[model samples]
Target: MMGLENGITDIPYEVHSSEDLGRYLIAARDLMPGDLVLTERPLVFAPKALPDPEACMPCVGCYKPVLTDVGERCAKCGWPVCSGNCPGLRDVRHHAAECEVLSLRPDCVLDNMAEYYRHDALLSLRCLLLQKTDPENWKKLLEMQSHMECRTPGTESYDEADEFVVQYLMNNFINKFDGKLKKDVPESSKAILHRICGIVDTNALEIRLQQGTELLGLYSNTCVMEHSCIPNTKHSFVHSPKDKNDVFKITVKIVVPVVKGSHITTMYSHALWGTQARRQHLKDSKYFACKCQRCSDPTELGTYLSAMKCLGDGNNPCDGIHFPEDPLDDESDWACNKCKVKVSSSQVNMLISQMGEQVDNVQMMGGSVPTLENLLCRLSTFLHPNHYHIYSIKHSLVQLYGRQPNYMSQEYLDKKIKMCNDLINITKTLDPGNARLSLYRSVLQHELHSALVLTSKKANSDGSFKSDEDVKALLVEAKTAIEDALNCLKDDMEETAGKKLYAVIEKTKKEFEKYCKEKQLNI
Candidate 1:
């Protein structure tokens, strides 16, 4: 066991290592829900590679997107910055050290849009620069996991890092520094650069700013927690905007009661992905196969996220659902629980791939009610009602209803209500602790409240709208739903969508209560 550094003492957690789990954080004291377990700023942070060529380029200093045709550039380095006087460009820990390095490559033309995409190397360069500027923190970073062996010469990971990061840095800047080295880069320096790249890839967490600029941040203590599909803790970030000197930091809070010796966990994969998808992602990116409880269960704890309807041959149509016999094995055959009919893993993969493509298409087409409904209708025959694709489509549908004037009909409202209820149930079952799915569940709750409020106004078959008693009952439910939604978003930072939604829902809740008071409809 090693003590945590970076002034991370007196927290309810201890850093422990095991043969199987490597270095991980464990609860040193009993933790209750909402317990503030950890808070730490990034060891290093940098802008992500511009994934969208058509999108505005981000300022290298402050990471804000350059919205105007020609944005401000740093006075010293000539790199894009939100302003010529950006503080981030002056901060020693951020762009200050690298600004010197980038200045060395003055001849390199950065006018091309493709040149902006080279920002992938920016983070690794920052990490490498730490070796000189912040040597102690740099040592701490090297102690983190790199999994270098898994990313050897022939691997795609190796090739990407080698070409984009290591070679770029050496050829453009490092080799030219002081004109001290030969044309050929030294193996030791190259190895360190590669190791830095791996560390960033493995440890960095993806973050999106309020303005929708995406970046990566590597934390010292927070990155040490182990990964779980159903994490016991939820983390929120405090992003620093240009006007605020509030450096970016993260807060990790316990979402469920955990015993003193339990592992402090955080999710590394999307909560909505199926077992295979999650496991494969972990294996590919983190270089480890996840054997978490959720991954081991083929039925995904009965939510059936990956299950498909087992349509038997023409003569004998079976009504069983197909699930992986051994979910941990990538090539495990899928079998029907009822009819015992078997399907190859390849066949199942193909089906999932094809359905996923269709789902993507529908989402790209704006996910309108009619499109999602038609897709859901066609897919309900071949997929379980709770399939992740179906779940995703329904999630889109949940928000679409009541937002548009044409979607306020009884049928759409009914569908929205049903979808909200079903999604809420599935999300809760998968994330019983409500840590990983807080924002998602909050959105569902808000949508459900909206649907209920709208449904209360529809005329009954008897030609009368909802009675005072009925409307009051519905309003009470709506109030509870909004309250829960607000509770889930209470930790969200300002200027975020969650915070805006919270304000809107708070007003809606007041209106609901006001209507009840005016009508004299006491509960």
Candidate 2:
């Protein structure tokens, strides 16, 4: 058995294999919420598959964004690099071995290449080259489960265009390596190249490196954890402060308690997404039909995340949630819980698609308060108040309420406070202990502090404070809220959102203390 490394102990987790599911991770003992479970470094890391037109020139070694106009390029191959003598480029990077091979191959030339073909083959090429230089790491990679045989035309995993790119890498690149590399490579076989591509597609996680660049990282042990719609654990990528540009580690923590022997799983699909959308995305990307509890429940654990508002022409609209007749089948009819009215799956699909487009447009408007409010009002005509679409809009509104220009009024701050509290309640049921929950709680506390301070100031100016006790009470509430916000934000300081919240909370606390001293109240 492969044991946990890096001083990870008392984790209460074990690795197991099954005939049907291959390898998976399970809890060996009872695990509780907020427990640290595991940490790992990637076996192989490469840039993500960027859209052809949207591809930016990131450094080949550390994956840092490097502008083409002034950035350095590799001396031999002319690919993006931090500097000619960069430590990663000189001796330790993946680019060192492939640079010479790419420099000689006629078809491997980088100039005037199409956008789609730029990054599609880079990860596979890196894996193949690793076999020559880092044999042990290559061997570990080969042990991974790659569902290459299942990539058929009729299946959800099929992608004809990507497959063509894999073929090009094998025929035009790998098969034409330099004589030195050719002798080092075991065999210039397309089958091996295909398997490498399949492995990356199946198991790679999107790592958000420093400076906001995203890359694909392959973790040997963490990859074995299965997917769940409502996952028990969450993972975060922590970049090394000593070398922020290149080094990163994945930290997985338990978000919910689990019994001994229960499977330890993480979310592949977003927790906020509707059931149908989440399941469809899993099927298309991961090549699996999810039968998790959330997928099986028609009401989605009574959250009604996918419900549409009934358009009945009667005196009262149908007070019912709409759900699929058979939760597992996409073509199943949808029925109303109260009116017993049925809607075709095709119709529901069309409606959702159209609404999704509108939501995208509103999101693209840069989270303006009026624009989001208008969008929410329009969405309510056809969507339940608690629908994911409406929830998303409200979530955006809460974030923008106090930050936008002309939105810091006392009225607006009170509105923001109420919205934040409401969101916290919903998130407790839908995404408990999520980083988003920490964010929401912090924002709610900050808004509460702002509103209380503003109210206290107005009352004092208007000579409306009946006694000093009233002012003391307001100051106490504001101080407590700021403290709560600080506690919730303690673990998230590395993230941009968390840093911003921390700064705001600290500033507010200082201001509150100053005001308290002015009143001579014991805080």
Assess every candidate by TM-score: 0.93, 0.87
Instruction: Find the candidate with the highest lDDT and give its number.
Output: 1
> Lowest lDDT 10-mer window, candidate 2?
108-117
* CA deviation > 4 Å runs, candidate 2: 4-11, 49-55, 91-94, 106-117, 153-164, 241-246, 313-316, 403-411, 435-501, 504-523
Error of 1 at 224 (Å): 1.5
Local accuracy by lDDT, each model: 0.82, 0.73
Q: Write the per-residue lDDT of candidate 2 for residues 75-101, one digit (tens) a residue.
A: 777676667877667544446776765
lDDT of 2 at 10: 69
> Candidate 1 overall Cα lDDT vs. reference?
0.82
Q: Write the per-residue lDDT of candidate 1 for residues 172-287, one digit (tens) a residue.
A: 77877763222222322888989988999899987777777778889877888999998999887777546343367777888888999999899999899988889988998999
Q: Could you tell me the lDDT of residue 312 within candidate 1?
A: 88
TM-score of 2: 0.87
